[model samples]
Target: MAIDDRVGQAGSGVRRDLRDALAVLAATPRLLVALDFDGTLAPVVDDPEKARATPEASRAVERLIALADTRVALVSGRALKDLEQVAPFGDEVLLVGSHGIELRLDEADDVLALDADERQQLGVLEQVLDQMAGTLDSVWIEPKPAGFAVHTRLASERHSRVAHLVAINELKAEAPDATVRLGKDVIEFSVRSTTKGEAVEHLRRYTHASAVFYAGDDVTDEDAFVALTADDLGLKSGVGPTAADHRVAGPAEVASVLSLLATLREAHAADAPDTN
Candidate 1:
């Protein structure tokens, strides 16, 4: 499936049903669960570092991991090392970090190398952003191991707008080889040719998931949601116009849906006959 060209209205009963369907998919035998980290799994907080998975959500994810057929992936903007710090079950969930630029499973040192152009551009952008940082206050440039983010979240309302414009202009001109991307309060410049949509496609093939269910709350995550087919599920985390098939109130609601899924999985396991 291609990126959904149709950007639909954000709220509707139809959107709600999609979230309901995601709860159902969570119970299926072969599950490929992909989630965006920041505003989806953890609540949006003042300090990004304090953003940790809620205890209940973490526990539920652990239970879901216990299911033999389930495969979970944490797809996030953070670098692999940072993602590892906050994820619930260490190494249990496949970590697709740096906007899927790097992927790893069960090993810290283990990493999937990014494409050649991405490798070269990332090096150049790192230096350029650092030099421009002093001029852009509240517009700090976050240097991930694999990529970089220009954040305007801390900027005053007027400066926030200015910061975005300045960063976008600078990144485009300086990092000609990199992919410049826009998001909520941030602009990401990466060397990866592959977008989030492509990341989902790779995971679909790797896990052979019959149905793909992806959830996220940011603009960058829309690419993945748009990539979903009719059979797949795409859930939006907040109130807004989205390409996602489903919509939820917030992170707490996402946890509830996940918990319900675990219950359904346990019930299914109990019903299956044991050969032993």
Candidate 2:
């Protein structure tokens, strides 16, 4: 589909859901805007370390952060340290990494700990994944504190399928208790049970937000999308079946959505009655 057509479809939801979402956000006393990093704010890249937010997305987030009673956050499946490197927007933007298992707000960093048995199982799983990667061309393993990921983004389609199957079978045999999530061209396994849904809920409570706006572009992001309530907005940045109420073609359209939200929020703030 054409980019404009996709964006139009996103903006024109069932009976103006987007419009209603924006209106609620504008009048909300406290707002929490959380976005997925990869494929939401930034395009996916071969080198994961090379990913960065698009200029438009960066500017829109900055504008949102500047608005009164508005908080902006990046929630991702990446490790906290890796996310910190990719999204270096300082302390203003909250960071939820490791698929909500790791959180960094301001200087405080909270990471979930794995018990000895879980750690041992993860280690075995990692070793098996490494062995499996050696057999498949262009397949690599990403080590994480909770577990690890098998990445096949650069592999051929057939090879990717084979590698993923092999990895899943091995993970099932070795660490059946591990939580597995499939996204794009990657399969992530974690010993801890956490989801972007829990992360968004935590942020909502932490910020005491009256309304929330979350945007993402992956299967794992469906957790965050499902977390949204009537008072919140969920945006899907790419195509495929999703729980998001709205859809945008890609990062550019996501930027436009955020920009509009920031503009509306700023106007609302300006028009609010002053208690002072």
Each prediction's TM-score versus the true structure: 0.84, 0.92
Model 1 residue runs over 4 Å out of place are 1-27, 106-120, 274-276
Off by over 4 Å in 2: 1-17
Error of 1 at 142 (Å): 1.3
lDDT of 1 at 135: 72
Local accuracy of candidate 1 as per-residue lDDT tens digits, 148-193: 8888788888877876676668777877667777788777887765
* Worst window of 10 by summed lDDT in candidate 2: 1-10
Clashing residue pairs in candidate 2 (N, C-alpha, C atoms within 3 angstroms):
none
Report per-prediction Cα RMSD to one decimal: 7.0, 4.8
Residue by residue across 1-276, what tens digits does model 2's lDDT show?
232232343333223556656766667899999999999999989999999999988988998999878999899999999999999888899999999999988676645777898888888888888988999999988988798988999999998999889888988898888888999999998888799999999999989999899999999999999999988899999889999988878998788788767766776777788755
Give the lDDT of residue 13 in candidate 1: 25
| Model 2 quality (TM-score) | 0.92
